[model samples]
Target: EVMKQPGTNVIEVADAVLAVLPDLQAQLPPSVHLVIKDDNSVNIRKAFGDIRVTMLVTLVLVVGVIYLFLHNASATLIPALALPFSILGAFTVMRVMHYSLNNLSMMALILSVGFVVDDAIVMLENTVRHMEAGESPLEATLNGSREIAFTIVTMTVSLAAVFIPILFMGGILGRLFREFAVTIVSTVLISGVVSITLTPMLCSRFLRVVHAKKGLAGFMDRSFDRLRSGYGRSLRLVLRHRLAMLAVFVGVLYATVKMFGIVPKGFIPNSDNDSLRVQLRAAQGTSYYEMVGYTQRIADLIKQNPDVDSQMANTGGGSGNQNTGRFAIQLTPRATRALTAQQIAQQLRGPLGRFPGFRAFVNVPAALQIGGFRGNSSFNLTVQSLNYDELYAWAPRLEQAIAELPEVEDVSNDMELKSPRVNLIVDRDGGRTWPPQKCQALEGRALRVA
Candidate 1:
């Protein structure tokens, strides 16, 4: 039986099933077997786990660096508090706006970790500077926050300006990124508010003065001071040699342009996931059992790889043709496997390419499948002609030419013209004069031929 949860996510539904799967399997007959044909829940769970790990690691590293520079655990903790507050607050807003906790939003939250802590760190640093100058914590908190309040606001607005345009982009790209951009902008704005309000309050209550000691932290601080001084001196030198600086800037710009032109580009980065969709097509006149046999052989070949967890083959539904079939290959989760779905697909392609009388294409599903974007393959070219014969004649040559391109791989055309047809002709006057049974016999013969 198939079931769906109306208001719950696929991950939740899968978890609910897993909780009872063992018991359910135990009650089944020894000869019967149960298999999940396709489960997107695993992908969702893995992606969420990865995002969580990324956020946690980022927070730890950020806090550790802050403590190293400030040499005070209390000061480090002040900025660290902003990370969760901003993220949780963003979640609250997301819930109210009806956004789910999907990969794009999770990625945005992870990326926002850097920006979310920036305002808090800046405010804390400024407050520490005033404390070092011998001001009381409360006074330093008020004055330091007041000093950088405008700066934080300006930073938030500038970041928002950059991401807000993405919300207005039309089509699949826009739909995929709109949630990501909104999550970032919202978290940054929340962080700004926290920096000026909660951050200063925490600093005033918890921040304390620390005396310098002879250690690695003190040595690093002294080195940083020297670096800042040298940078100031360089700035003054550049101001004095404006023409030389301009020439150097132009040379750097030219180098940047040339480097950009040399870099390879693609529509989307291939995700290293654990599932692949292998589409197979046999010759037009192939029998149903022959197609199934071919698909079973392909499945057997796929199962030879240790990473493969399961395989499901579906025949006779592809483009309404009996010769076409598809294999849904599931592999072990990415953490437990060394090869990605795409890599495994490539490895299998070598053997499948040698399979006689059949053509195969492999692709991983798209990360986000939106309207008009089927996401089944990497690229698609649509050919249209008013004349059917001309279209049929031109399509094969175009397909072959594209297949021969050095950069292209697994090229195939959707236009199939192998179905047999029969034309029926009758003398209208004589047929009208004939008995109805005679006309029926002629129609049956035409249908049999067709």
Candidate 2:
């Protein structure tokens, strides 16, 4: 019944609510029942599943590709081990920093998988090359790591430097990107540490001396050698024809810059969260039942949508405004539905748009509903003047102008001043003469009617 405060954890709130459910139910009459439903837990579980699945798929692919190239189980295992150690270490750092493993952070972790394994792969390959050149395992490990240590450190620092600025960005965007950027930087640094230390140690302990290869392993080795030679030849050719290469590079860069204007731009991308809200506002003088009727019609039409899982409506005193009500439509989970919450809201708009004597808006809630950015609608316009008469006079005309724009929909104004009210004034002498019981009775009746 109450809107959650900004930045409050929905899951924790739901848990606190459930913890006191037994006492609440006991205090209520037998005919009354409390049913608690929430999507936070479902959302959390889905986020975890998505992160797990994405990491697992990346792990499998990386392992497969490594095994295919190396053809040695021990060599592949060395680099693969970096994945778990780097991720676990990043998680530990995140705990220390009080970061939650939400969707954005998890995505950052997934992306870091590619970068994390790079240092390990480079060190392992270099060490293997030393071993193939007839050095002892310990000597190969030491020499190989020593040679690549600076390179790995530089790469890690460079990657971290790219994201560090994002942490200092201002406002909501800064908050959102800070977690993602820091997570990547932390994971990459951890991966670099594990690469130079654990990776070489494991290679020295478990890696075997290379022997003459045949079949698929030999073919892969020869193919890689050919690719390396070809790349070297191409590099030489490009260096020899510097002028032609420069022209081609400049032309490609210019084309890419020109294409930037064709890309769609927005502050934030739309997310499919499987929930929609419908705000209903009746005419200023509309009664509570009349508003309830309008809300019911809208809810009924929304229920007809196959993607809708459940819905709740509020009217009368529960609604925020006297002539306003709200409907919360919970759609089926994203996996079970093809349409996004925004699309479903658009579909329901047709029915709600036809409702008589009511203005309704259907929208998905914002990811973070901060001050002046409720996300209930696309845009908000405020008309302020020192004189109430001038403000009210111009507000409707402005609202109508905005509503007439081709891109605007569900336009509404909260400036209506025509609501009917009855003010009761009791004469001091008349009330002094009235009996206490009569005054009490009148007050009780007014309260009941209200």
lDDT of 2 by residue, 1-450 (tens): 545676787677767777898998999999999875445566767767878899789889988999998899999899999999999999998999989888889899989998998999999989988998999999999999999999999998898888899989989899889989889999999999999899999999999855888999999989999999999999999999999999999999999998898887877667766788887877777898888788778777888899998888887655267788877778888888888888888888887888779778888876555675343375566677999788978888898998899987878787768854567675898788898888888884544223
Q: How well does candidate 1 score on lDDT at residue 7? A: 64
Model 1 global lDDT (CA atoms, 0 to 1): 0.84
Model 1 TM-score, 2 decimals: 0.86
Q: What lDDT tens digits, residue by residue, belong to model 1 across residues 337-435? A: 877888887898898889998988888866654446332356777788999999999999998998899997888877768778767785678768888
Superposed Cα deviation of residue 131, candidate 1 (Å): 3.6
Clashes of 1: 0
TM-score of each: 0.86, 0.83
Look at candidate 1 and tell me the lDDT of residue 350: 92
**Runs with alpha carbons beyond 4 Å of true place in candidate 1:** 1-8, 17-29, 317-320, 333-338, 368-377, 423-447
TM-score of 2: 0.83
